[model samples]
Target: MNRKQEETETPSKYMNQMIRQQQKQLLRLLRKAGVMPDERIEVRDSELLIGLFSQIRRLPEFAEDKKKAAMLMHAMDTIFKFPVSRATVQKIYYRNKDF
Candidate 1:
Protein backbone atom coordinates (compact mmCIF):
# COMPACT_ATOMS: atom_id res chain seq x y z
CA MET A 1 0.00 0.00 0.00
CA ASN A 2 1.01 3.63 -0.46
CA ARG A 3 2.33 5.69 2.42
CA LYS A 4 -0.88 7.66 2.58
CA GLN A 5 -2.93 4.44 2.72
CA GLU A 6 -0.69 3.04 5.45
CA GLU A 7 -0.97 6.21 7.46
CA THR A 8 -4.72 6.23 7.23
CA GLU A 9 -4.97 2.55 8.13
CA THR A 10 -2.63 2.73 11.09
CA PRO A 11 -5.02 4.71 13.26
CA SER A 12 -7.87 2.36 12.49
CA LYS A 13 -5.70 -0.60 13.38
CA TYR A 14 -4.59 1.05 16.60
CA MET A 15 -8.13 1.91 17.55
CA ASN A 16 -9.24 -1.68 16.99
CA GLN A 17 -6.45 -2.95 19.21
CA MET A 18 -7.35 -0.44 21.89
CA ILE A 19 -10.98 -1.50 21.72
CA ARG A 20 -10.07 -5.16 22.07
CA GLN A 21 -7.90 -4.40 25.06
CA GLN A 22 -10.72 -2.43 26.64
CA GLN A 23 -13.06 -5.36 26.05
CA LYS A 24 -10.68 -7.74 27.74
CA GLN A 25 -10.37 -5.43 30.71
CA LEU A 26 -14.12 -5.06 30.92
CA LEU A 27 -14.59 -8.83 30.81
CA ARG A 28 -12.12 -9.21 33.65
CA LEU A 29 -13.95 -6.63 35.70
CA LEU A 30 -17.28 -8.30 35.03
CA ARG A 31 -15.96 -11.68 36.10
CA LYS A 32 -14.39 -10.19 39.21
CA ALA A 33 -17.70 -8.52 40.09
CA GLY A 34 -19.61 -11.77 39.49
CA VAL A 35 -21.44 -10.28 36.54
CA MET A 36 -20.02 -12.81 34.07
CA PRO A 37 -19.33 -16.45 34.58
CA ASP A 38 -16.71 -16.95 31.89
CA GLU A 39 -13.70 -15.15 30.52
CA ARG A 40 -14.76 -15.71 26.94
CA ILE A 41 -18.14 -14.40 25.88
CA GLU A 42 -19.45 -14.61 22.32
CA VAL A 43 -19.64 -11.46 20.22
CA ARG A 44 -23.28 -12.19 19.41
CA ASP A 45 -24.10 -12.08 23.11
CA SER A 46 -22.42 -8.75 23.66
CA GLU A 47 -25.67 -6.85 23.74
CA LEU A 48 -26.97 -9.03 26.56
CA LEU A 49 -23.75 -8.64 28.48
CA ILE A 50 -23.86 -4.89 27.92
CA GLY A 51 -27.34 -4.75 29.36
CA LEU A 52 -26.27 -6.76 32.39
CA PHE A 53 -23.31 -4.46 32.90
CA SER A 54 -25.58 -1.43 32.71
CA GLN A 55 -27.81 -2.93 35.40
CA ILE A 56 -24.84 -3.81 37.55
CA ARG A 57 -23.47 -0.30 37.18
CA ARG A 58 -26.73 1.10 38.46
CA LEU A 59 -26.64 -1.02 41.60
CA PRO A 60 -25.76 0.81 44.78
CA GLU A 61 -22.74 -1.39 45.30
CA PHE A 62 -21.20 -0.65 41.90
CA ALA A 63 -22.42 2.92 41.83
CA GLU A 64 -20.40 3.58 44.95
CA ASP A 65 -17.27 2.50 43.07
CA LYS A 66 -16.82 5.41 40.72
CA LYS A 67 -13.70 4.02 39.10
CA LYS A 68 -15.24 0.71 38.19
CA ALA A 69 -18.47 2.33 37.07
CA ALA A 70 -16.53 4.67 34.84
CA MET A 71 -14.63 1.77 33.35
CA LEU A 72 -17.85 -0.06 32.60
CA MET A 73 -19.32 3.01 30.96
CA HIS A 74 -16.22 3.44 28.84
CA ALA A 75 -16.29 -0.20 27.77
CA MET A 76 -19.95 0.02 26.83
CA ASP A 77 -19.34 3.17 24.86
CA THR A 78 -16.42 1.67 22.97
CA ILE A 79 -18.06 -1.62 22.16
CA PHE A 80 -20.88 -0.17 20.15
CA LYS A 81 -19.73 1.90 17.20
CA PHE A 82 -23.37 2.81 16.67
CA PRO A 83 -25.82 3.84 19.34
CA VAL A 84 -27.65 0.97 21.00
CA SER A 85 -30.92 1.81 22.64
CA ARG A 86 -31.90 0.70 26.12
CA ALA A 87 -34.99 -0.99 24.71
CA THR A 88 -32.81 -3.02 22.34
CA VAL A 89 -30.52 -4.02 25.15
CA GLN A 90 -33.44 -5.05 27.32
CA LYS A 91 -34.91 -7.12 24.53
CA ILE A 92 -31.61 -8.86 23.95
CA TYR A 93 -31.25 -9.52 27.68
CA TYR A 94 -34.72 -11.02 27.96
CA ARG A 95 -34.34 -13.13 24.84
CA ASN A 96 -31.03 -14.51 26.02
CA LYS A 97 -31.83 -14.99 29.66
CA ASP A 98 -30.64 -18.58 29.48
CA PHE A 99 -27.23 -17.39 28.35
Candidate 2:
Protein backbone atom coordinates (compact mmCIF):
# COMPACT_ATOMS: atom_id res chain seq x y z
CA MET A 1 0.00 0.00 0.00
CA ASN A 2 2.71 2.46 1.11
CA ARG A 3 6.04 2.90 -0.76
CA LYS A 4 8.00 1.05 1.95
CA GLN A 5 5.51 -1.79 2.03
CA GLU A 6 5.70 -2.21 -1.73
CA GLU A 7 9.49 -2.34 -1.66
CA THR A 8 9.56 -5.00 1.10
CA GLU A 9 6.90 -7.07 -0.56
CA THR A 10 8.75 -7.04 -3.87
CA PRO A 11 11.95 -8.45 -2.37
CA SER A 12 10.09 -11.15 -0.46
CA LYS A 13 8.22 -12.16 -3.56
CA TYR A 14 11.42 -12.19 -5.63
CA MET A 15 13.25 -14.29 -3.08
CA ASN A 16 10.39 -16.76 -2.95
CA GLN A 17 10.39 -16.99 -6.73
CA MET A 18 14.15 -17.54 -6.77
CA ILE A 19 13.84 -20.31 -4.21
CA ARG A 20 11.13 -22.01 -6.22
CA GLN A 21 13.19 -21.69 -9.40
CA GLN A 22 16.17 -23.32 -7.70
CA GLN A 23 14.04 -26.20 -6.52
CA LYS A 24 12.52 -26.73 -9.96
CA GLN A 25 15.95 -26.61 -11.59
CA LEU A 26 17.22 -29.16 -9.15
CA LEU A 27 14.41 -31.58 -9.88
CA ARG A 28 14.91 -31.17 -13.61
CA LEU A 29 18.64 -31.80 -13.22
CA LEU A 30 18.01 -35.00 -11.29
CA ARG A 31 15.50 -36.14 -13.88
CA LYS A 32 17.98 -35.38 -16.62
CA ALA A 33 20.65 -37.29 -14.74
CA GLY A 34 18.43 -40.24 -13.80
CA VAL A 35 19.00 -39.73 -10.11
CA MET A 36 15.58 -39.56 -8.54
CA PRO A 37 15.61 -41.36 -5.21
CA ASP A 38 13.02 -44.07 -4.65
CA GLU A 39 12.14 -42.76 -1.20
CA ARG A 40 11.59 -39.19 -0.12
CA ILE A 41 14.76 -37.70 1.28
CA GLU A 42 14.67 -35.72 4.50
CA VAL A 43 16.94 -32.73 4.88
CA ARG A 44 19.01 -33.18 8.01
CA ASP A 45 21.46 -30.32 7.69
CA SER A 46 23.71 -28.42 5.35
CA GLU A 47 26.55 -30.90 5.86
CA LEU A 48 24.78 -33.68 3.99
CA LEU A 49 23.95 -31.28 1.21
CA ILE A 50 27.54 -30.08 0.97
CA GLY A 51 28.69 -33.66 0.73
CA LEU A 52 26.18 -34.42 -2.01
CA PHE A 53 27.26 -31.34 -3.93
CA SER A 54 30.88 -32.38 -3.61
CA GLN A 55 30.07 -35.79 -5.00
CA ILE A 56 28.41 -34.46 -8.11
CA ARG A 57 30.91 -31.67 -8.54
CA ARG A 58 33.64 -34.27 -8.87
CA LEU A 59 32.01 -36.10 -11.77
CA PRO A 60 34.54 -36.08 -14.65
CA GLU A 61 32.03 -35.49 -17.42
CA PHE A 62 30.22 -32.76 -15.52
CA ALA A 63 31.67 -29.75 -17.33
CA GLU A 64 30.13 -26.60 -18.86
CA ASP A 65 26.35 -27.09 -19.25
CA LYS A 66 26.61 -30.47 -17.60
CA LYS A 67 28.26 -28.80 -14.64
CA LYS A 68 25.36 -26.36 -14.37
CA ALA A 69 22.90 -29.24 -14.33
CA ALA A 70 24.95 -30.93 -11.62
CA MET A 71 25.06 -27.75 -9.57
CA LEU A 72 21.28 -27.43 -9.74
CA MET A 73 20.93 -31.02 -8.58
CA HIS A 74 23.34 -30.39 -5.73
CA ALA A 75 21.37 -27.35 -4.64
CA MET A 76 18.16 -29.35 -4.61
CA ASP A 77 19.80 -32.18 -2.74
CA THR A 78 21.14 -29.73 -0.21
CA ILE A 79 17.98 -27.72 0.25
CA PHE A 80 15.41 -30.57 0.15
CA LYS A 81 17.41 -33.81 0.16
CA PHE A 82 15.84 -34.97 -3.07
CA PRO A 83 16.77 -38.57 -3.86
CA VAL A 84 17.99 -39.44 -7.35
CA SER A 85 17.52 -42.72 -9.20
CA ARG A 86 20.11 -44.25 -11.50
CA ALA A 87 17.46 -45.36 -13.97
CA THR A 88 16.22 -41.81 -14.36
CA VAL A 89 19.73 -40.63 -15.15
CA GLN A 90 20.02 -43.28 -17.86
CA LYS A 91 16.72 -42.25 -19.38
CA ILE A 92 17.90 -38.67 -19.54
CA TYR A 93 21.04 -39.77 -21.34
CA TYR A 94 18.99 -41.34 -24.11
CA ARG A 95 16.63 -38.40 -24.28
CA ASN A 96 19.45 -36.01 -25.14
CA LYS A 97 21.77 -36.72 -28.03
CA ASP A 98 24.73 -34.67 -26.80
CA PHE A 99 24.62 -36.49 -23.48
State which candidate has the highest lDDT.
1
Q: On residues 1-99, what C-alpha lDDT tens digit does candidate 1 reach at each position? A: 458868876556667799889979998899899998653323555565676776777779777887777676666654553245646654553342442
All predictions: root-mean-square deviation over Cα? 12.1, 13.6
TM-score of each: 0.31, 0.28
lDDT tens digits, residue span 9-64, model 2: 65566677998899889978887788974344564453445455545544565644
Best by TM-score: 1
Model 1 misplacement above 4 A: 1-39, 72-99
Q: For each candidate, what is the lDDT? A: 0.63, 0.54
Clashes of 1: 0
Q: Return the clash pairs for model 2, or none.
A: 33-89, 34-88, 34-89, 35-84, 35-85, 36-84, 36-85, 37-83, 37-84
